[model samples]
Target: MVDVFFNTWDNNRINNSRPIDTNDPTYVIVHGYQSTGGNPGNNFTPQAWMSEMAQNIRDLEGNDANILVVDWQDGANTLNYFAAADRVDEVGVEVADYLLGQGVNPANTTLIGHSLGAHIMGEAGEELRERRGEVDRLIGLDPAGPEFEGGWFSRPNSTDYRLDPSDADRVVAFHTSSTLGYDDPLADLDLYINWDDLLQPGASTFVGNHGYAHTLYNDLLDGFGFAQSNGTTLSLSTINGNTAGSVFVDTFTV
Candidate 1:
């Protein structure tokens, strides 16, 4: 089952009350495979990043903002990658159903996901578009490429199966790991971080590189700037702005 947490961002509180302020910008955050919403025992404190990102969003938009964290641990926390991948569309449909039931305004919602969760957001976005309308924005952090892009198993060649520009009004993605993460441009704007070396600075393995997407996003939320080759400093505004197409950014540190 999927566990949705409505975060209040005050003392790590979770308010699951539905029918939140629809006018306020609502964020639905989803984690990737093998991770829970806020379980530390998974050796990866995904909840820590979620909380940090939520707090950062609250700081940017004040207390009126609504933050929802989706945890599909029963389906995602598994040893079988293909099985977990197969459940993406189903879980995404459920997520869409939940959001639609809560009367969330698509124009004021932003879906953020990492790895396999990114594809979940894509499926959810597609379902929402068909049921209601498209979301305002969809942020994909190094979308998983294993089963979807011919690694473990051959996936369908349809763009509908993966994230594309049609998923939302504004689709932005960050490609961090080429091996574990999707290498192709899967959104309106794809930002390739440390593309020259593939491995981000301070990341020893491809897994570390794959996991760094959320950290980079959190850093971007914290007002950290990434520099492009042409001496352009890309910030959160750059991602949210009217920029389109792939841009390369080199990360010098963690």
Candidate 2:
């Protein structure tokens, strides 16, 4: 279900105070690997971005959007990475089917996901195209790498259901956590932040690096002086199999 949350409404996704147009550009955000009930990094509970993300995007674009937050809490509540990772495939297809059933325009759709959620969007996009068409974008915020390293579950150039180029028209991956985040360029645009997992400031653990992807995305969208940073833009294909790793590109800015 699309748990629509707005500034006027409590996390319930319904508010009698205002009218939200369904025709607006939609942003469907899915949270990644988590355990239930405020377990800090292991939980998908509302982070700093959740509090103001929808409203902020709406205000920035000057449009009333149908911001759908897919809560796969039940599926993601396990510490078993394999189980949760398997569930991601199901959730991804289900979400894509939901959007199609609602008749949402694929051209205006943008799927934003973090970690496993990021790979979920890839699956969603691929399914959407098979059933409908390609989406505008699939933004991967530090996609998880543990169970997806070309192993039993995911393979780069095969039929495995890991996040790949075929998933969306424009797939963008933000690599903030090197060890945990996907080291390979899994999108049309792969953005490496802070030298690719050198450890984000104030990070007590490796998970902090993953969490910072959300922080960076939110801050960039909110606008800062470095939003228009000019840096060297290089192609991932030129790197050849990512043997070099850490492209050292500037963090993506909105």
Which lDDT values do the candidates have, in the order given? 0.81, 0.67
Look at candidate 1 and give me any clashing residue pairs: none
lDDT of 1 by residue, 43-122 (tens): 32346778788778878877777788777777887899878888888778888888898788888899999999899999
Instruction: Write model 2 residue lDDT over 1-254, tens digit each, in one string.
Output: 32222122224332334433448777777778872212224333454465455545565666456666566666786778778887777888888877887778777888888898898888899898888888887778899887776656656434247787778777777788877888778887677777543568557778898887777666656663233255433333322123232345544334
Model 1 residue runs over 4 Å out of place are 1-11, 17-19, 39-46, 151-156
Once model 1 is optimally superposed onto the true structure by TM-score, how far is the C-alpha of residue 74 displaced, in angstroms?
0.7
Supply every candidate's count of residue pairs whose N, Cα or C atoms clash at under 3 angstroms: 0, 1
Please state the error at residue 145 of candidate 1 in Å: 0.2
